[model samples]
Target: MDEHSTAAESINPKHQALIDRLSTRRSATTTSSDTARPVADFLSSFASSKLSIEQSLSESRSRADLDHISSLDLDQSSFDSASSSLLPRKKFSFRNKPQKKEEDPKNVAEISVEPSAIDKISSLSVRDGPGFRNEKDTTLVKDFRQCDVGQGEFTLSDLENCRVYLKGTVRALFFYRIRNCQVFTGPVLGSVLIEDVSDSLFVLASHQIRIHHAKATDFFLRVRSRPIIEDSNRVRFAPYRLTYEGIEDELKESGLGEETGNWANVDDFKWLRAVQSPNWSLIPEEEWLEIADISQCK
Candidate 1:
C-alpha cells in the first residue's frame, strides 16, 4: 500500500506539470492583448482551453483504466468540424455611391423651351390645314380621302376624353399628353411619336412607332418596323383592326397594305434581357375588340 501511494503521488505531479506547460504554451501563442481582444475572440480561446483540459483529463483516466479507454476513441475530424461551425462570421461592408434624383416631368416640360423657340414653333407653317390641339371631351374627325396628296404632319396635344379619327395617308403623327382618348387614324407614311399618354387606345398604321412615359395604354398597330418604347409600363399590343371606305387604296399608297406582323415585336429600351419585357405583351384574343368601322362617323 505505501508503494502504491508513492506511485500515485509521482503520477499526479507529472500530470499537473503537463497541464501547466499547456497553459503556458496557450498564453504564449495568443497574439492580441486582453484589452484589445474582442469578446467573441476571448470566448473562443476560453472554449479551446477548456476542451484541451478535458482531453488531458480523459487521457489520464485512460492510463489508469486501460479496458475502459480501449472502448472509447476520440474523432479528431468531427471535433474540428464542430469547432468551425461554432466560430463567429466575419463582417461585410457595402461601398456604393448615392445616386442623383430625376427631374419632375411637369417641371421639365415647362422649362424645356425658350421664348424664342416657342415663337418659332408658332410660326411654323401647316400647309395641309391645322392639326387638332388642346381639345377636350369632344369628337374630332378629318377625312383625308378628299384632300390632296401632300398631306403634312398632324398633331394631337393635351386632349382628354376625346375621340379622334383621321382617314387617308399622312406624313407623320405626333401625340402628347393625351389621356383617356380613342385615336383611330389611317396609314402614316412616316414615323409616329407619342409621349406622356395614359389610359388611351390607339389604332394606326405607321412605318415606325416610338412611345415614351406612357402607362396603361393599348396599341392596335400595323407597323413596318419593330415598335419601341421607353419608360412605359402596362402597355399591350395587337394587330391593327380598322376598316373604312377606300382604306385599301390608302394603305397601298402608304406601303402598308400587307400585314407585316411586326406590331407584337415590341422593343422596350428600358428592358434588355433574355426574358420577355414586363412592360408590354400581346393582347389576349378574347379581350380584343371588334374591327373599328369609322365610315359612319361622318
Candidate 2:
C-alpha cells in the first residue's frame, strides 16, 4: 500500500468514521444548491427570531416607563386637587379708580373720640368683680391687709371723679374708663392694666404696667418692668409715692422693695422715633407730690 493508505489504516475506526462523514457533508454542501439552501434558511430564521425577541423587550421597557410616568402625573394631579379643595382661593381685582384725597390731621383729631365710643361699648359689657365698679362721684376704699396671700385680681372700672384706695398686696389690678380720679394702691404682684383713663393721678407699684388710650394722666409708679403706653397723650411719670401702714412689708413681699428706678423708663408704642415721645414725660421734681398718705383715705 502507499503511504497515505498506510496512515489511514493506522487511525481508530471511530475517528476515521467521523472524518469520512464530515468530508462527505462538506462536499455535498459545496456541490448541491439544494443542501446549501437549507443551511441558509436556518441561519436566516435564527437571526429573525433574535431580532423579534430584542424588539419585544425594548417595547415592553418603553411601555413600563410610560406607565410609570402616567402614574406619577395622576398622583400629582390628585394631590393638587385635594389641596385646592381644602383652601379657598382668594380673588384680586384691579381697577383704575380715582384716589381719595388725604384728610387733614386736625379733622382726624376732631373725630378721635372714637376710642371713647369703643370704651362705651366695652363698658356696656363690664361685669361686676372683686373690686368697685360703676361708682360715680364717690369715694371707695378696700383694705386687703387681712386677705389671703396672692389675693385675686382687683378691678376699678367706670369710676368718675372718685377717690380710690386699695391697701396691701394683690395679684393684679385693672383700671378702665376712670376719669378725673385719684387712685392709690399697694404693691401689685403681677401687673396693672389701665385703659381710657384721663385727667387722673395714679400711685402704684407693680411688676408690669400698661396704659392705653389715656389722655392727660399722671403715673407715679414703682414697676419692675418698663412702663408702656399706647395711644396715650400728655401722660407723665414719676417715682411711686404711695404710703400706707405695712406698705413697706407689702412691697418687700411683692419683690419691689428696692427703688428699681424703672418708673421713668416709659415706652410709648405710638411714638417710635428717636426724639422724646410726645405721649409721655418725666414729672419735674417740683411737680411731684409728696408720699400720699392713703391710711386715712376712704
Candidate 3:
C-alpha cells in the first residue's frame, strides 16, 4: 500500500510537469490567444497519459494499439481533406485601370457633324412697297394740299412700289429691331439679301446674320396676318434674302458675333455652323455627314 501510494505521488508530479511543459509549448506555437487555457491543459494531460500507456504496453498490445492509432490518424487526415473546403478564402487580385479602345476615323467623323442648319428661300417681303409716305419728315398731308403732287419726278420709292413681285434667297439669319416698326422684335425678315446671288452670312441694316453652310430647302416664308410674340415682344417670322455686308465688317472688325460666341477665326472649321442654333434637331441620323442640296428639297 505504501509502495502504491508513493508510486501515485511520483506519477502525479511527473504528469503535472508534462502538462506545464506542453501548455507552454502550445502557447508559444499558436496565435489563438483567445482559446481557453483549461481546455488546452486538459488536452495536454490526455496526450501525456496516452503516450505513457503506449510506452508501458506489452509488445503484442502495443503493436495492435499502434495499428489502431495509425488507422485513426489516417481517418483524421481524410477528415481534414474533407473539412479543408471550409477554410477562409485567400485575397483576390484585380486590375485597376481599363484599356482604351481604338476608334475608326470614319465613325468618329460621322459622330461629330454640326447640329445647326440653314433654311432655303432666302428672301421675302415683310410688307408690300409703294406707299406715298416714303419718309415721315419728307411728306406732309397738309403740304400736299398747296403743292402739285401729280408733277413729282420718278423716285426709288416709286420704282420699289411698282414691283408686282420680288424673288430672292436668304443670305443670313438676323433679328429685326421691333421698336422702329409696328412689328415686334423677332426673326429677321429678308435675312439674305438677293442683291445678286451670293452665299454667305452677313449683317444687314445693323442686324447680325450668321452664314452656316447647310443642306438647303425652298420652303416659302409664311407670314402671319397678326404678329407673333416670342420670348421678347418680338414678332417671329421667316424672311427671304439675308444681306451679308454688315456681317463682313463684323467678321473683319472684332471678328466675333453673337452666333460665333468665342470662336473668332473664320478659317477654323470648328467655328463653322450651318446656322446659329445649338440644337441638332433637324439633322437626320443617316444624313449627318452629307450636305443637303440648296436648290431642292428631299
* Candidate scoring better on lDDT of 2 and 3: 2
Residue-level lDDT of model 3, residues 1-298, one tens digit each, is 4533444454456555645754665555455544444446556556775566435432224446545443433233453453233222244766675668789888888768634322122232223322232332221111111234221211112111111111122223222111111111112232322211121121122133232222121111212121112111111113322222233343233222233221121121232456632311222334322221222110
**What does candidate 1's lDDT look like per residue over 14-53, in tens digits?**
4455446535544554454542344346456645755564
The local distance difference test score of each candidate is: 0.77, 0.76, 0.29
After superposition, the stretches of candidate 1 with alpha carbons farther than 4 Å from their true spots are 1-129, 148-150
Candidate 3 residue 52 C-alpha distance from true site, Å: 13
Q: Assess every candidate by TM-score.
A: 0.57, 0.59, 0.21
Model 2, position 221, has a per-residue lDDT of: 93
For candidate 2, write residues 19-132 as lDDT tens digits. Answer: 354345445564556555544454455346435543443444455643443343323355345433432333566687778999999889888855665656365454456878
Candidate 2 deviation (Cα RMSD): 23.9
Over the full model, what C-alpha lDDT does candidate 3 score relative to the true structure? 0.29
Output the lDDT of residue 179, model 2: 91
Q: Which residue pairs clash within candidate 1?
A: none
